[model samples]
Target chain A: MIDRLAVIGVGLIGGSLARALRAAGQVGEIIGCGRSQENLELALELGVIDRYAQDPAIAVRDADIVFLAVPMGAMRELLASIGPHLATNALVTDGGSVKNSIVADARVAFGCMPPWFVPGHPIAGTERSGVGASFPELFRQRRVILTPLPETDPKATARVRAMWQATGAEVSEMTVAHHDEVLAATSHLPHMLAFGLVDALTRMDCSDEIFRYAAGGFRDFTRIASSNPVMWRDICIANRDSLSAMLARFSTEMSDLAASIRDADGEHLLEVFARAKAARDGFVDGGKSLAEHN
Target chain B: MIDRLAVIGVGLIGGSLARALRAAGQVGEIIGCGRSQENLELALELGVIDRYAQDPAIAVRDADIVFLAVPMGAMRELLASIGPHLATNALVTDGGSVKNSIVADARVAFGCMPPWFVPGHPIAGTERSGVGASFPELFRQRRVILTPLPETDPKATARVRAMWQATGAEVSEMTVAHHDEVLAATSHLPHMLAFGLVDALTRMDCSDEIFRYAAGGFRDFTRIASSNPVMWRDICIANRDSLSAMLARFSTEMSDLAASIRDADGEHLLEVFARAKAARDGFVDGGKSLAEHN
Candidate 1:
């Protein structure tokens, strides 16, 4: 019945998943694993999991499911150490932002494509990270994109989809490569722009005064730039190719728009602004939650 | 004491100021004037003003204080109509976003700076507009930037500054040119970029699917893009030169950033990202209300 579950790297995503599973009564036992002893203690204290272990191998010893919630860069080392320890019937998944690299690692570590390895990315998070920000309803009304590899088993994919659906998330599937590309366009490139904008503003020496006067416009434009540097650093590295391509395309568009504005072409500027406004409305119309951000 | 105050264009900013003034017992009677009969009726219904007049000239006939809360484009026409009727000693102010253009309008309409005509920009707003969104605390803890022209009366400026302080806002003084430039860099250009980015995304054939998958970053980046189109359009035109300059600078930076990423220059990308992250932190450190967004 896939009752017992052990989530490695019990940070915000993993801990929150544990909490949701318990609240929904979807699993029998929840064991939390992380490199940080303090985080493990906090997860247990928060009642996100019933037990904990330090080693990834020890944590997944008898579990029916294991989630690699660690950073993408750390996934290879983790999968290598724990792959042989996982029961053949156990489902292995991850909450990593990038799926392709991790999918490759899993294949290499397990000596073949693991039928039960279903990679997923939950489109939900907050600027605050680690176990401190974990909550059961974090995924409520959120989208969870599943990018199962070609060799993934249909039954395993269904199980993973069902698990996320139980958390009140809508599940959809895409190929790993497509997921990386689409996300780079929609998510990663925006973060890069935000980070780049803020950096440019900071180096301008006018930041202190500029920030003081930052009203609604600046607040929203720069909000996502306040995310954890280490986490974002890893994301940028892991999804370099897609991010690079998206940034190039975005820069081209930005330059074109800039040229139109510089020429005082109000009609052109209005057309661009109108298009953006329509797109934003379409996003709201798509029934996505504006809550839960980073 | 400013017993009877006349609010021009009884919309969000004007109505909100009237409400706040009434709540603070700072005014004995609040009279609202607007071209729209329905707006006048709505303003009265919402208690945004104690009374309403169809003509601005009649509304300010006996008013001790007059606040122009119309769009920048409408400012000149409004001042030209109401200038001769303003009570001789009345203190006049405005809630316009762009100050440079308004200053010029005030100078031409009033003929040798009116004793009470003060240019002010309250750096506070919501995504919603109109009389319905007006609230008493809209200015609390918000910045109120005042741009006093070369010939502005010192007494008039002080009176205007005191009025803003009563609404619980911190006041700063700057030149009209500088005010427009600073705001263009911080507010206007950012909005334009948001609108442009969203527009670019929307114009793409894959907009529907892309929007459906938009997560935190895209949503935040595009939120300001969804702000009142009319108001933003006016802002872009009124502050075009400064906005153009800022846009050009930002585009250059974005281009450089894009090139850095495309070249797989991780070190350069990380540096840029780090600077942006720091500036955003500094903005938060400067106490911009990011939490209030959601």
Candidate 2:
């Protein structure tokens, strides 16, 4: 059980982690900190946190555990500010979408890769954001991926895993590069496609009619386009390499599809479509392992 | 009420139309014709059709309305065979995704554009297809766009519109070119993207881990990728010009996005993302007109 938990940036992930630990009766005191006083107060009223601290340094000063849940853009500054005040033994982790960049931020801030810092991410969310949208059950049955540096203390990693497991999340460990690469394919690329598609349509001369005649299929395809743009912008900049690589690969295949259509190659079109349907069906029905966890 | 309604294809759209008309007491008889005898038998058992016919010519022989729900690739053959058998006054409409090509098919089959033929497409469906996957309420509150040739009889178009309206669909009319262009951007483009995205990932070395780590967003984005491959293939080829054009425009934008990501131009990414979110929000919250029918 956590003696004192410091949650910096009381947003969806931060607030939910606190709520889950409180609901599971596994935490003593939760200190919420953010730039937004209103959001911190809402977290306190919602019982998502025990008290509020406007200063990140103050928030992490006496905590046994500290969670960084702000957007990717804020991670570097927060890490720097809290580094000087953190309890020597506090296990530090984060819910940042991009692990490699934030791990670099930790390395720079702490003047080295701290053994107490365990970088992690929970693959659970809705379109909504903010503390008001958080719930204690947000992480239940979800997957939390941790990418701990080799020099990290095993006990620190265990504590982070135990915290997530307490919230009913299945925790898995991977190398930082692998976590970034896998998520770039699974999550980041899809969001970029959705955002790019919508942005492209809006730029067209027929934009008005395009959205007007859009069917439910179009809506579902663009659902992720409605996601927070600033956060996604940060994500784009955070994981630039893998995302650009995936985009180039996808663009090549897209050009092939366009050529196939131009040539009216029914056989080629059918083969690609059939293959896609098979892979998507397999993934949806049960990706050898997807069905087990999700 | 119609004396007899002949529905060729007998899949999701065709079966649902028959069930809706029957439920509303607007259709006197529904004769389902398809390549699959088992599917037709299931439709009859489910009361989606009053009877079944193996040949399209025999099916449309005595019908007042002929609804062609076959894939775009099969439209030419069905039009040719049914041309000699259809009643001169039959108001023939279709559920094919492409309008311009189907009109071409009708012209080729009849040696001219028939006044009795009115092409229509209902913008409603689930990922599931086949007669068994159909339901009567599928078109309720959904939009159906009809495109009629200039030489087409107004009464024929009106009858087709009334037929769809009776099934709780909101019907609108536009020229064949407009219908093809609008649908290519809204429906066809999104389907192609989903199919292409999934197909590209499957070709990657990390395809196994890609599908395994996929989250709910990836699943939702690829939902349409699981649609009937043959039908999508037909749609892609049938609307080749417009679909290819849209793909080119979107691909250019995708390249720009990739360059911005590589350059780490946060401003470009932020602006594009914000604009897309705004437009998507407007459409989803009710595009100037997307709000009404859907």
Candidate 3:
């Protein structure tokens, strides 16, 4: 059990984690920290955190585990603030979507990558945000990916994994580069497509009729387009290289698809669509899609 | 009241309409026709249809209304098969996703776009298809677009509109060209993106881990990828011009978004994301998303 846990940026991610730990009876005292005093008070009143701190440094002081759940753009400053004040035995982790940037920030903040700093990301979210939008069940049956640096302590990683496991999450580890690239394919690029598609329609088609007539499938398909924009922006910039590369590759494929349509190549369209359907059918039918929980 | 109704292709779309009409007591002598005799039998057994016919011609011989719900690829042949046999006073409409191709097919088969043929599309569907998946509530609170020709009988259009209204759908009308363009922007393009994205990832990534670790949001966003591949390929081929144009425009926008990411233009990214979110938020909150029904 965590004796004292510090969760900086106590919004959806951190607030949900705090609630999960509280529900599991796995934590002693949870301290919520964020730039928003009102949000922190809300978190405290909701019992998501036992107390609150406005500063990351004070929040992490003497804490057994410090979880930085702030947006990616704020991670560098957060790392710098908490590095000097964290207990020597304290384990530091994060819920940032991108790993390489967090690793880079840790390296710069500590002058060397500390063995206690374990970078991680929980692969779960909704089109909702804020402390009020969080719940203990958010991480249940979800995947939590950890990208531990080479110099990180194995015990730190293990403890982090155990903490996530207590919340009913499946945890695994991968290299920072691989995590970012894979996430680019699965998470980041999808967000970009959703955002870009809606934006394009809004700009090109002056009529709101375009969206009005969009079917239920389109609504479900573009649900992610309603996600928090600032957090996604920070993520886009943090994982720029992989996301940009994926977007370039996707754009080329789409162009090719357009050419096929132009050439009236129903055969090629059927081939690609059939293969895609097979992949998703297998995944969703496997009973491990994690789609049911959400 | 209708004395008889012939529903060619007794799958999700036609079967759902049959069930809805029966629930409302608005249809009589529902005749199911399809190439799949087993499926047609199932529709009859489930009460989605009152009788089964293997041939469209035989099915519509005395029917007062004919609702063609076959794939776009099959619509042309089905039109030809039923044209000579349709009742002289029949009101014929279709649930084809594309209007222009269906209209063109009717012109070729009947030697003219018949006054009784009202081209219509009900903007409702799920990834699941087949007669077993049909339900009376499929079209509840959904939008159905009708594109009636200038020569089409106004009484036929009004009756078709009333039939859909009986299913608790909000019915609207537009020209054939506008209907195809709007659907291309809203439905067709999103399907292409989902299918293409999944297909691209499967080809590039060798490990099944990409699909295994995909989050709930990713699964929901790509749910449409699991839709009937043959049907989508047919839609793509039928609405080639509009879909191709939309895809080209979307690919360009995606390329531009990628450039912003490569250049680290977080502001531009945030603006696009925020606007897109607003559009969806308004639409979903407006209680017209129809996502709740599905």
Output the number of the DockQ-best candidate: 3
Query: Mind giving the per-residue lDDT tens digits that candidate 1 earns over A1-294?
Result: 357899998888998888888888898998988889999898888888889999888999989988888877788889999877987788888898887778888877888888888999998887667988889999988889999877899988999998998888889999899888878877887787677667756766666677778786688888888777766777877887888777666667777766765675667766776677776876776663333431
- Give residue A153's error in model 2 in angstroms: 0.8
The reply for model 2, stretches above 4 Å from the true place, is A287-294, B287-294
Clash counts for all predictions: 6, 0, 0
Report the C-alpha lDDT of model 2 over A21-104, residue by residue, as the tens digit: 999999999999999999998999988998988989999988999999988988988999988898877889999999989988
lDDT of 2 at A87: 83
Give the runs in model 1 whose Cα sits over 4 Å from its true position.
Answer: A108-112, A288-294, B110-112, B288-294
Better of 1 and 3 by DockQ: 3
Question: What class would a CAPRI assessor give candidate 1's docking?
Answer: medium
Predicted candidate 3 versus true structure: per-residue lDDT over B208-237, tens digit per residue? 878877888888889999999899989999
Model 3 clashing residue pairs (backbone): none
- Per-residue lDDT for B7-64 in model 2, tens only? 9999999999999999999988889999999999999999899898998889998899
* Isolated chain A TM-score, each model: 0.95, 0.95, 0.97
Error of 1 at A73 (Å): 2.1
DockQ per candidate, 2 decimals: 0.58, 0.82, 0.84
Q: How does each model score on TM-score? A: 0.92, 0.97, 0.97
lDDT of 1 by residue, B193-277 (tens): 6776677666666767777787776777878887777677667778878877777777778778767655656677667766777
Error of 2 at B87 (Å): 2.4
Docking class of 3: high
